[model samples]
Target: MYVYRSHDQQLLNERVAQFRDQTRRYLDGQLSDDEFLPLRLQNGLYIQRYAPMLRVSVPYGMLSSTQLRALARVARQWDKGYCHVSTRQNIQYNWPALEDVPDILAALADVEMHAIQTSGNCIRNVTTDEFAGINGKEIEDPRPWCEIIRQWATFNPEFAYLPRKFKIAVNAVPDEDPALIGVHDIGVQVLQRDGETGFRVLAGGGLGRTPMTGEVIGEFVPWPDLLAYLEAILRVYNKYGNRDNKYKARIKILVKALGAEKFRALTEAEFAELKDGPMTLTAEEVDAMRSHFSAPAYDAIDDQPPALQDALASDKAFNRWYHTNVTRHRQAGYAAVTLTLKKTGRAPGDITDEELEAVADLADQFSFGEARTTHQQNMVLGDVRQDQLFTLWQRLDALGFATPNLKLLTDLVACPGGDFCSLANAKSLPIAEEIQRHFEDMDYLHDLGPIDVNISGCMNACGHHHIGHIGILGVDKKGREYYQITLGGRGDKTSRIGEKLGPSFDTEQVVPIIARLIDLYVEQRQPGEQFIDTYERLGIDPFKERAYATDH
Candidate 1:
């Protein structure tokens, strides 16, 4: 994890002081609601369906034990006793009083954290794969570049506000893309061409009412010109993106309006002019960024310890969790473990302050006092020793963090819908819980194989329903909650929007309909086939017929 420098600490302090004054002025009636709206939004404060919700940024999803302890304290002290981890790798406190947000911000700054650019129509948090540094197949740690972009884009005068919100992601893994870069406003895949690290840049990918996979704009951009190239793309969008209608204001809309070829041409033209500008990244600058994320010392040992194998043989639950939750690490004798937050009944990603502190303690003991958050609403300890897997699993089980359901059907990704957001037409969390409960059997889930079930409250696509293998979107029909289902969606290297499965189903019908779809998949799938592969091979006809059966 990168420790904050003096300058970073100073910036956060100043931002807290500024926002504190802004809040006081608004409370004093010195500022109108309209004037205070954007100000509060920039600091990640939002008036939700209930009280104010504050989003605290976890830059690139990396956290130190001290930072996690600070967050746990804030959760207990200022807001409710829990916080929700968002899909964008941020944290949200759903029940903060309006007057205390500035105080929360001040507390966050005390630990070298803040909520800047977490919301509003500006560039949001720059995200990457949670397993960046530890993934065995990753070409390089992408966080250095993410940090570079974070510095460049944070409060950049030119992009404080755009046509709509913008998102950027980076993926360094050659064989896979765990970061979902395909759905970002700007996506970069790091590459090494002839001994020089560079980037393959894409633009105009996003989700919402209009979902799009980003188009590759630059096949290879030298690292020196990476910043300038990004500036060029943003400049194009800032100048040409739709500002007339909020619905059509995203860069995805602009990319569609102008074909990918034309958009690339425009960006290239802009890049030619700025390629040699002051923003061009130098070798020294890149090294400095890399220095912040240096590797930890490791003992020389075999990849897997003999004790781990013996433990796996003795315990079924530990074996299941080890197979599903543990991922191979870059160093021998070390593993990265994904602690699932998708347990049934509890809101996905919501953790109590006690749970948070316990996880922080686990990180301190097992993962070098550092942890990372995933886009799938999970926590990861990126450096647990292979020999200590059983002990760590025991601790996680005690903390209610050991679900053993990574990439399983019941591990659903969902947003705080009508229960929390005023913009939601139907509640999504309950629907997620219903589906999760219906498939709570671990044997049944593992037998069903890898699947993604994403649920969104509305078209804002906060849940990223478009990318799930089984996508459910909440809708309002005759003032009642309903859901629209989609199939065959994915968010990896090959990403695409899901196809709808006909008319919407009422709240009561959603679970059975999903069961019907899964049953159909189980019946018709080829040997060793997953749900998504079967859907893609046979198309949506079989599932559609079963899902829409009126006979119940």
Candidate 2:
């Protein structure tokens, strides 16, 4: 994890005080609700349907054991005993009091974390692959670039209030972690051609109402000009993005209205002014930033320890978990482990304070005092030695964090929908839960292979329904809650928007319809085809026909 320097720490401390004063004035009636909305939002406080939801930024999803402990303390003291992991690698407290939020921000600041720029029309938290430095597949660690952007965009006066909320994502290996980079307002793919590093910059890609994958504006902008090129894209968006209607305000709309070619031309015109400007990243500066994220000192061990082999041979359950939740590490003998947050009866990403504290402890004991949060609402122990995995699994299993459903149908992505958010048309948690209950058979799920079932309470797409292989969007038909189904959506390097299956189904019919679709896939799929591949081969016609059949 990156340690905060003196300047960064001071900035966070001062911002907390500033927000505390603002909060006092708002509660004292010195500031009107209208006047205080932006201030509160800037601090990541949103007044939801029942209570205020405070979103805390976990930059690039990195967290030190100390930071994790701080988060646990804050949740215990200020929130309901747990916090929800958001789709953008953030933590959300859905039950914080309006007055206590200042204290929450102050607590976060104590650990070099803050909610600044988490909401409002600003550059939100910069997110990337959870397996950035440890995973062998990555071309280069993207964390340094994420931090550079986080520092640059943090309170930039020009972008504090844009046409709408802006998001940026980067990936070192776009081909490997395809979903992380494709669905952001600005997406960057870092590449090294020859010995020179550069970026493939894309702009105007986004979801919610109008979902579109970003278009490439610069195929290869040198490392020195990365910031300038990105700034140019933001400039174009700020100038032309629709502000007349909130519905049409995102950069995606702007990109669609002005075609890709025209938008690229406008951005290039702006880039001409900033190519060699002050914001151009320098080699020395990048190197200095990179030093903060260097790998930890690792101890050597065998790739497949006899102890691990013995444990796998003895325990089928542990074996199942090892096969599903463990991933290869860049260093030999080390492995990256995904801690599943989706326990059967619990909300997809909710973590209790005790479990969080235990996770922090596990990080100190097994990993290098650190763990990273995943965009799919999971956590990663980035450098666990394979030999210690069995012991770690036992500890995590006792705490119920070692579920073996990674990449399976039961491993779902969802948002706090009508249960908490005022923006939602229906409750999403129940739908996700019902689906999990309907398909709890481990063998059935394993046979089905990897699939993403994402549920959004509304078209706001907080759960990224636009990118799920089986996307479910909640709708309000008249006054009743209904779910609209979509098929063939993906958020990878080859991104595609999903198409509607047919009419929306009542709330009671959602799970049954899903079961029908799953049954259709299992019955008709090829030898090694996953759900998405099978859907691509067979199209939605067969699934739709089977799902909506009279008997079903």
Query: Model 1, stretches more than 4 Å misplaced?
Result: none
Question: Native-vs-model 2 lDDT?
Answer: 0.88
Displacement of the residue 361 alpha carbon in candidate 1, Å? 0.6
Model 1 C-alpha lDDT per residue in residues 1-552, reported as the tens digit of each score:
667889899988899889999999999999999999888998999999889999999999999988899999999998789999899999999999999888889889998889999999999999999999888789999999999999999888999879999999999999677898888999999999998999999888998998989989999999999999999999999999999999999998999899999999999999999989898888898899999898887778787789899999999999999999999999999999999998788888888898889888998899999999888898999999999999999988987788899999988899999999998988999999998889998899999999999999999989999999999999988899999999988986567899999999889989999999999999999998999999999999988889877787
RMSD of each: 1.0, 1.2
TM-score of each: 0.99, 0.98
Q: Summarize candidate 2's per-residue lDDT along 373-478 as a digit string, tens digits.
A: 8888999899998889999999989988888998788889999999999999999998988999998988888889888888999989998888888999999999
Candidate 1 similarity to native, TM-score = 0.99
- Compared with the true structure, model 2 gives a TM-score of 0.98
Alpha-carbon deviation at 443 in model 2, angstroms: 1.4
Residue runs of model 2 more than 4 Å from their true location after superposition: none
